[model samples]
Target: MTSRFERGVTYAILALFTVTSLTPVLGILSTAFGRQSSLDTGFSLPDGLNWGNFADAWSRAHFGTYLMNSVLVTAAVVTATCVLAVLAAYAFAVMRFPGSTVLFYLFLAGLTLPQEALIVPLYFDLRHWGLTDTYWALILPQTAQSLAFAVFWMRAYFRGSPRAVIEAARIDGASSWTTLWRILVPMGRPAISTMVVIVFMWTWNEFLLALVMVSDEAHRTVPLGLAFFQGQHSSDTVLLAAASVLIALPVVIVYVLLQRRFIEGMLSGATKE
Candidate 1:
């Protein structure tokens, strides 16, 4: 059992880390709400809540179009990645066939390759294929990129699943597809939810991929839009802060909604192999 002194130290350390992490966010919030004229007062609370900052930022930045593009791209990437990863992971975990080990290792190789290394060739390939400046440019590449980690994550969970449960399902004369979809998938809700949150955040915040793959304004994601917005409004701290908040709000909302499952998945040993 943990000692009282040890528990107290742990809580104190966690509290310090929490405040450290939140300090920058609080500073941004203060600047977002502060009067435009008070830009010189660094990190101080606003005299009054300036709600119009968000409205003005939204209008000036054209976030609606960018946000919608991000939503479409993120949703597509997450859905595709999850479906493909689950199928691939289930096969690796439960099925055996010729060259399965080699194939699985090849998938794991993707995790070692960084996006920067492939961006140039990938751009040329996408351009050659006439996919540049399109949603497919964003969605397809990101889905493929995310699949590496997604497969790795879900495979561990599937491998750690109870053997008795899998045997019982097999004894029921269930097909592999039925066992995966009905029994394993439902049982791994926490792990899947955790993967969703991670992949959503990654896809939503992806900037370099968007920049290299897409040049059309219609295909720009939030991070790309925010970069241009920042360039144009470099001096407008209030609007910048507000726009930053807007860009981050969706990710924050998603994590908040899935916080419990994410934590549960992380803390649980079900992913151990």
Candidate 2:
């Protein structure tokens, strides 16, 4: 009875925190649909909801093009990060090789390195290859930046996996790649889901890299595009708010769909502790 009361109290506290955190987001959401007159209005649902604001923002900002570019770049980044990290992590966790620990630590080292430190070198490196202002510039750098986190996540999941299962696969003459593809990755769905959510969030919110790497307006990502929109529509608060809602929609949708997996992955990771 006492334990149940404690659990209920903890849940109440958490609920309060969740609502507090969501207050700002809710405010933006409210403003996005509200009338221009409502900006000065008190905090409540708009007296008149304006659906035209979204349509106007979309048509005026060339958001369709921006959305396409973001989709392409984000898809490439997510796919590359997942595949490379899973392979590298399986190698480190399951394979017996020389300097394995050293190599893993090297990958771990990347997690601590700031993007600002590498931006200058990356700029020159991309420019030398004549890749600047291209999708490759954005896709390549973001993929690389996200790889360290993916590898670390997959490695931890793999480390916690059962040794007997891997040994049995090896006993059956499964090659390293075969074991990773057939056994490990299939079982690492929780980790993969977590990685997907994290990578998507990072890629979606990435502004500095997109702003720096993508010079052409056509190639601008959503965040960078938002900045562009703000510049172009500085006085049009209604349009800006509507664009903000559209920009934030994809992430919300993805989260809604995969939230179960994400929560399971996160909780399971903590479960091991």
Q: Using TM-score as the measure, which candidate wins?
A: 1
The lDDT values for all models are: 0.92, 0.85
User: For residues 210-249, what per-residue lDDT tens digits would candidate 1 score against the true structure?
Assistant: 9998888888889999999999999999999999999999
TM-score, candidate 1, is: 0.97
lDDT of 2 by residue, 149-229 (tens): 888888888888888888999999998889888987878777798889889989988998887888888789888989988
Candidate 1 Cα outliers beyond 4 Å, as residue runs: 269-273
Kindly give the number of clashing pairs for every candidate: 0, 0
- Candidate 2 collision pairs: none
Q: What TM-score should be assigned to candidate 2?
A: 0.93
Alpha-carbon shift of residue 159 in model 1 (angstroms):
0.6
lDDT of 1 at 28: 92
